[model samples]
Target: MPRNTLIAGGVLVVLGVISYVASAFASVTALIPAFLGVVLVICGLIARKKPMLGVHVALVVALLGLVGTFMNVLKIGEVFAGTAERPLAVVVSAITFVLLLIYIALGVRSFVAARRWKKADAISQA
Candidate 1:
């Protein structure tokens, strides 16, 4: 596996932990990112050993991250409807949004790398 893939996975796991801990004080909806973080970590670990598996897993994670980020962007207004009442909510939302972007980028990179690795492996075997 590429070093970047491993690094990305590690970063995702750490971010997931952060999200999980941060969610405790935020609304129930915050758990969504927390859950995603765990999934990403598991997939990342698996990908480290099997590029073919990583390709599929990383792609899924990338797609989900994109969708999640898009949905959150659309709902940003609703999230910050009462910014004056709860400033922390805005901060947390922003943090989660940024993390999602980073996660998505890393996932895509890993996915591409995995695909290349798989192709190379096939060529070598033949």
Candidate 2:
């Protein structure tokens, strides 16, 4: 991994660890999505050198993950407590889902391209 990717991945790995810990406590479960966002951002940054489209998609997925987490908190608050449902949560969730689909598509495309590149390089060397 490049310097930036290694750095970002390290951060994400940390965040993921924190999130998993937080899940063990009721008070911290709500923050899980935000932590997931941090991880996604790390993944995106790490993959930046691989493909332009994939990078963009990763960034978007990170943003959506943030929104999804926020929505999850809101939904939980509304259902369990007296808090009213926040429309923002719904909006964010929708956007996040769409972005996730795009991210997966880009990831697959990048994987295919990378494979092709390796094959071409190997053939040329031979």
Q: Which is the leading candidate under TM-score? A: 1
The deviation in Å at residue 121 for candidate 2 is: 1.7
- Among these predictions, the greatest lDDT belongs to 1
Question: Under the 3 Å rule for N, CA and C atoms, how many clashes does model 1 have?
Answer: 0
lDDT, candidate 1, 50-119, per-residue tens: 8568646755675666566564455556555753444444444455567656655765676688779999
Q: Give per-residue CA lDDT, model 2, range 1-126, as digits (tens).
A: 223333433454455455545446434433443455565666556565554544555556555564555545446545446564643334334434444444555556766888899999999999
Q: Ten-residue segment with the worst summed lDDT in candidate 1?
A: 83-92
Query: Which ten-residue region of model 2 has the weakest summed lDDT?
Result: 1-10
Where is model 2 more than 4 Å wrong at Cα?
A: 1-33, 45-86
Q: Model 2 Cα displacement at 118 (Å)?
A: 1.0
RMSD of each: 4.9, 9.1
Candidate 1 Cα deviation (angstroms), residue 23? 6.1
